[model samples]
Target: MAEVDLSVQRYSAEVIAHRHAHHQLVLPVEGALSLSVGGRELRAAGLSGVLVPGEARHAFAAPDPNRFLVIDVPLAAAESLGAAPWIERAAGGPIALDGAAALLVRAAAVELDAGGSAALRRQWAGLLVLTLAERAARAPGREPAKLGRALRYIEEHAHEPLTVAEVAARAELSPGHLHHLFRAVLGTTVQERVAELRLARATELLSRTDLGIAEIALRCGYADQSCLTRSLRRRHGVTPAALRRAARAARPAGPGRGGG
Candidate 1:
């Protein structure tokens, strides 16, 4: 996936119009903002915002100087949210953020503004995406069973060698069915989820262990060191060796060390 740019923008009462190279999320922190995009007029009041697709012509206006968080994410990032019919229908609509979502957006904006590293930005973006996904699932007339099950499975067996067939069986659905569900509910596949889990475990191992790359790979369910390297590079754009070196440098000098 491509990198996303997150920033906080304060808009005055006047109308602002522009097109972006990537999809944009305009989340209002205070007051209300109205957006016009592709002939659709949407209003976001309280804790809410609008999502505009890449290269889509859009305009916004606020009743006063309103504070908002602007997230410019790749189109692929929006796929997860777009899985919900309501979200799809509300494509150019303002999504109401509630307290949790509002807090997450605020934190994301702060982290982006702090000039954090790429890794931190990626972590924060994941959080923000998750928050939005939860809100999208709770929208009126949305079903939660499939999404609930998938999330539960990912959390419970993140350490195991997870596969699409296995997770689909857990949900009592076919692999194809699960694929559709994941695309609709999470904007990614079961394979991606498992890779994410493995990569997360790899990070922990790198920081806290004396284990070699091959050992870590075996523990994380990769067939071998090469497999682990491929998955990690695909997911994080970094190799295990580099990550291990960085983690080692960051660790304090100590006698006791471990891996989980």
Candidate 2:
């Protein structure tokens, strides 16, 4: 526990519970994860991340072709988060980070995979934990349990043709209640949230991976590359190609690639 441990990992579909002496941050780099932290069921995907306190019981499962950035932080650095509402506060996630948190995890992954140093890894992990804690503290009130449930359903299914009715049913709420919940709690409509999720994922894939636009479109649930292009342009005012190019340019040149 002298250092924060960081790695990209995947899990089998079979559920398994893990309890560790160290706190853990489970964020998706590519796909979704169904996990429970201390009896609170949640899902982690692009912007939806899980923060597990030290010694808490957490179990998870995910589909194939998925990757997650798992950070194991020593309890000392993470102790400040021990008393937050792990269940309720996680509702608006996907926790209220917008798209930046997911991108940050991807950046950390690059350095980690290349065997970067411990100091940098600790900084990345600390920033992530601090953000999660701060947001939870800033949340207005106890998050409606149904809202959290609806968010989980959406994170797991937003890539498909989604409907408010479907999401409401999954959360065991009426469509009207779901609508009101989104407006009251999140201040956005269900469709908009789903769209935000899709586009956020599209942005991550375009900027991080070398995958083709069409494939990225499919993964993000767009009808085609053009649809994804339209959404990206409308929301972020950029094209997929331009996003990719900028990401590549901003990335630091890798070692062993230039003159020694």
Candidate 3:
């Protein structure tokens, strides 16, 4: 049986090009990337996605540090799925992921980072492909314009102390309406999304930069270093120090520069 692989991946500043026999989906949770798929230029950011059909050559480069929930769907698996995969359903370009679909991808990234089981991730991969594709097909006006603004607001201000009310205010919605929308559309609460963004940034900085753990914590909106450490321990099962140590061990020692 063909298997689905799900993982959180990062790309360097270098533009790397490759092709595979299977389809791939790149869901951006953080920074942007310039992607070239079959000579079509696309931007992977602001809760957007890039769909690479089987054997379609693609190249991507990140201008800053980034994180993406990458799904590798084998050709046989795509062909075998009950529903046609997104690549088959859509025109094969940037997938217009709605607020909920983007949140789902973010949630899956959290699970993958925390060593979620392969069986569980495979389940998520299928849902993600379907949701993104379905959402992409919906009439553009049906998508709440405020939701996109809300998500972009959260991304821009995630580093500062935030509140649901503040985010709702930015999105021009009442707190109650914001909560309702988040639950009904995104299947998550605002608090969960805030924490997810904070932790994701914390992890990205931990793994990719030479910054101190305490500073990384401050930058990610944690109250302090211990707050950050406890959150990481609770969610990711590791401390910032341990995460950085692991990251360092995985790479060759050399001159280091900070990445966004």
Report every candidate's CA lDDT: 0.64, 0.70, 0.73
- Prediction 3 TM-score vs. true: 0.58
In angstroms, how far off is 4's CA in candidate 2?
A: 4.4
- Residue 105 CA displacement from its true place in model 1, Å: 1.8
What TM-score goes with each of the models? 0.47, 0.59, 0.58
Residue 36, candidate 3: alpha-carbon lDDT: 85
Which ten contiguous residues of candidate 2 have the minimum total lDDT? Answer: 251-260
Which of the numbered candidates is closest to the native, going by highest lDDT?
A: 3
Q: Count the backbone clashes (under 3 Å) in each candidate.
A: 1, 3, 0
lDDT of 2 by residue, 184-236 (tens): 54557899889988987888788667999999999989999999999989877
The deviation in Å at residue 145 for candidate 3 is 2.0
48 in model 3: Cα distance from truth in Å?
Answer: 6.7
Clashing pairs in 2: 47-94, 48-94, 93-96
lDDT tens readout by residue for model 1, 10-119: 65566778877676667755445678898887755444467776678888776443456666667665565453343345456555454456667777777766877778
Error of 2 at 78 (Å): 2.2
Predicted structure 2: lDDT = 0.70
